[model samples]
Target: MVRRHWINLNGMWDYLITDSRILPWQFYKSEYFPFDGQILVPFSPEAPLSQVKRQLLPDETLWYSRTIQLPENCLNTESQRLLLHFGAVDQICSVYINRKFVTYHKGGYLPFTTDITDFITEDLTVSILISVHDFSDTSYHARGKQQLKRGGMFYTAQSGIWQTVWMEIVPNKYIRDVRVTPDWDNSLVRMRIRVSSASSAENASPAHISPTAADQTDSQGTVLAFSPDRQNSSNVICKVYPPVFLEADGLNDTLCQDEITTAAIRPGKGATLSIPENMQKSWTPKEPWLYPYSLEYGKDRILGYFALRKCDVQIADDNYPRFFLNNQPYFQSGVLDQGYWPDGLYTAPSDEALIYDIRAMKDLGFNMLRKHGKIETDRWYFHCDRMGMLVWQDMPNGGSSYHHWFVTYLATLLNWMRIPVKDLHARLLSRTDEFGRQEYIDDIRDMVRTLYNHPSIVTWVPFNEGWGQFSTKKVTDFIHRLDPSRLVDSASGWFDQGCGDINSLHYYFLGLPVPESDRVLALSEFGGYSLRLPEHSACKNIYGYKKFTTSEALTDSFSRLMENTIVPSVKKGYSATVFTQLSDIEEETNGLITYDRKKIKMNPLIVQKWNTKLKKSLHS
Candidate 1:
């Protein structure tokens, strides 16, 4: 149930940076703090728009305050339940409404919901205060590329409220969350939904079962899904609504939820439910097809959709592994998307912005996005689910001391020289970085739980470039145990403990080479070939693999990289390749698009022609 009328708790908020040794003597709802002035919501303090453009020291904690009037309906609801939702809050967040502490959430990225119904009053105002502290890469936490002092590869630091804030109203009994997993092998989709009843006891059973008019999608279709355990029981029968056609108008028209497609339901098992064979649709980047099912469950409702697709790795003729999607081997063309924005930094401005990145890349013939370092907002994964873009999600690296000078030079350099570089390898061999190790484990558990539902996410990468390197086998096993649906890439760049799905490689300031015989080879990072558009560039001190002065040279070099290295090698054995980046990030100029997104460094046709050539080569 998407709420439409609730006020956005985003925008301007009162904030205070304090070294407080004591709690506020008397704090209340909607009350202002000692006004340290206003800040833009959803943008970190370190960002340009966050107003307080200063980084919080490790010892210091940030305080924030804001007041909002409770809506008339919130206080007067028949069920008398009001729910507040925080799309995401960094590190940790303690929430309050009307001067009472209600809940707190830990984890840098992932949504949390709270119940504020019992605390609501007609004349009451909603009050909130939050605190945030981050050490970024300094201390071992999922810091991604954030550092106190930013330079090559690492960008600005971001903190506090970088996601949406909103509220929702629901009846005494309503759906809380739904886990939808689609299985093409059985032509079935699984739904495990939770419902909450406002008046019921804390752990009481839900009010009722069986969905009603409230069960729906934006397409005006009724909701219905199969209950595998009760399949033979015709107790619940459904008729599909209208069909949605989005491609006719292309980018100009918004794609509306056209209809509710219903399926049979059984109680517990997945085998009982069956999807008609003809209705099955395969999802691919070129033709990303998503079928929405407006699921109904006894009056309460939520939107659910799934794509019919299969991804697996199989031994090929050349003895190297190949990636097959929907039974066909397709070479994966990917870009390293940090998922950062100029305005929001770690977060995108809106859901549309996230979808646009995938669509834009798809239009240029790429199929995958290697999410670099950071785990993204769930909405980002939702966009990927409905849009048909494959993802290689990374677990943000955080741990004891990174060997910047030695690791990259000795390990990565010597690997190119075919020399094994090992001092002791993994965190087990190093005793000093205990804090980094524990933090890594904590973040990994949070990552798997948060991103488990998205189908587009096909792989999980735990570490990159030997940053805070630790136990590879243990971490890899943990991720697989959490969700075996997708592939796992244990180590992205260097310090290979000889575990994981793809034998990944990072090739920058170098050339792509044919991989060895055995594992599925992925050129995880390469072709940083760059061209600077002076008018649109961030600055002159930027870096890239090879600097090109002209579009012709850049495009020619890119084409050569594909024709000679990528395309030929893909045909031989390689399954996927990750280009250096999607956009020019701060100091990194080797991006397909300029920093501001105002200019395309290479002509679209040049890229398209080569992509098409590669596609044809793979099929041939």
Candidate 2:
């Protein structure tokens, strides 16, 4: 039996609005800002659910205050590490507990936790204060598809706590962080653990997710046997006490990793298990098998999992390049999943909603999904890994304004002209503001570290369509060095920097792009065929390459476009195709699913059949 409990800290909470500082006791004792509004947790106020439904202006501060109660047994342990987690707080955030300033975190799309066990006492009436400032298109911060003025493709701004907020108590000595690196050539998952401080008396229990299913034609492999709590890792946790750093300088990455000699008593400094040939069942859309495990460091224990799969750029017999999985040619059929919801802006409405998208896409024969621009919560990646889906995760782009003509128009024309853009892109994006350049580097690293473990992620796209593009060659190589495990799409669209794993392309307002002879060509983005169902559309203002009123016509046009353009391009070396989107966002109506998630646009079986043939043709 599994232990599970999550008190939904969602729903309505008494909201008190104030600009200046007033004693908490003073406000509650009398009537204040009578203009009340209901704001949904895990969803920013800019979203529909947040009754205020307004943007977080660049120059203005949006303050939010809410009180929460701890789970029944959470505060019972006096010696435990009581941690509070925030999925995300855009731009910046300052946290408070029971009127006491506890910690502050500064990344828009990363998870952060603080130990409030000591300050927290009695019946858990905790006051959380978060302040956010988002400069969607005004400043150089990572703002994916969030437009303050809102038009075309960009929608709305998501600020302050758009993901779950909960409390968990860990034993003094516990597993702080787990990094699993899978070595396919060696047939093992190299495990690394970050433990709490040495003085912490808590125990550490380590474990791994073991797959039960055996590959009939190949030999089955096992992970290294985990050992009990021992000591710590060589890495150190930078922030020892309250008020964590506003922005962690990459300066702290390795140097701050505390030196811990005592960890698990396992014999393997690294472990290797044998994977029998042919008996191995490589992860795929049809059958997704996952192995979940747990680990302990001191008294702290962490749960995690992984999948068996491999991807790389290999030259095919016909002399063009392609992505190979397990040494076999596999066409990456994907959908452009813009991580958004009618209720939750950057956040998914629920975990089930995230899983629904992944499973639904898999059922439709899509083996891959390009996590477009926006970064999704960990739960989303976990689902993709467990379900055996391929992923091309994009690094959210943020920099000075795009060169409108070069990025939107001229670059698209360059795609038609068959011109390379490494030199051109470098020159264009180099002129961006200093803050923009710094933030891009900061967010990309955070993005990679956050999703490093999930087996489903196979590609890292640094920039998209020339937005915030810079040092194309160097950035591509840098990511390759940071994580050599996956492919790197240096530039994903019209900005064709001659770097990265494959020659990524995006075609809209036109037919399928022609594959080049030198590299593996991928229709990374295209087919933004739209269907406007007034009942389910996110907003009345619509946008797409083309729009259809009926599903039959949409499906027919999609199938015909693929049969003539995309299918033929694959044979000619175009390795993958990620359709416009997964769901109809505010203005984008080109998703196979609707914004309301009420219906599926195309027949799953039909789409599956087409995808099956597409894969087979590539290998054939």
TM-score of each: 0.85, 0.83
Q: Name the regions of candidate 2 deviating beyond 4 angstroms.
A: 1-8, 16-35, 68-78, 121-125, 198-281, 423-431, 510-518, 603-606
Best-fitting candidate, scored by TM-score: 1
lDDT of 2 by residue, 98-179 (tens): 6677887766878887887777657765666555556567777777777777666887766766877776667665555655
Angstrom error at residue 37, model 2? 4.0
What's the lDDT of the predicted structure labeled candidate 2? 0.68
Runs with alpha carbons beyond 4 Å of true place in candidate 1: 1-7, 21-23, 26-32, 75-80, 121-124, 197-272, 296-299, 317-319, 350-352, 419-436, 509-517
In order, the Cα lDDT scores of the candidates are 0.67, 0.68
RMSD of 1: 6.1
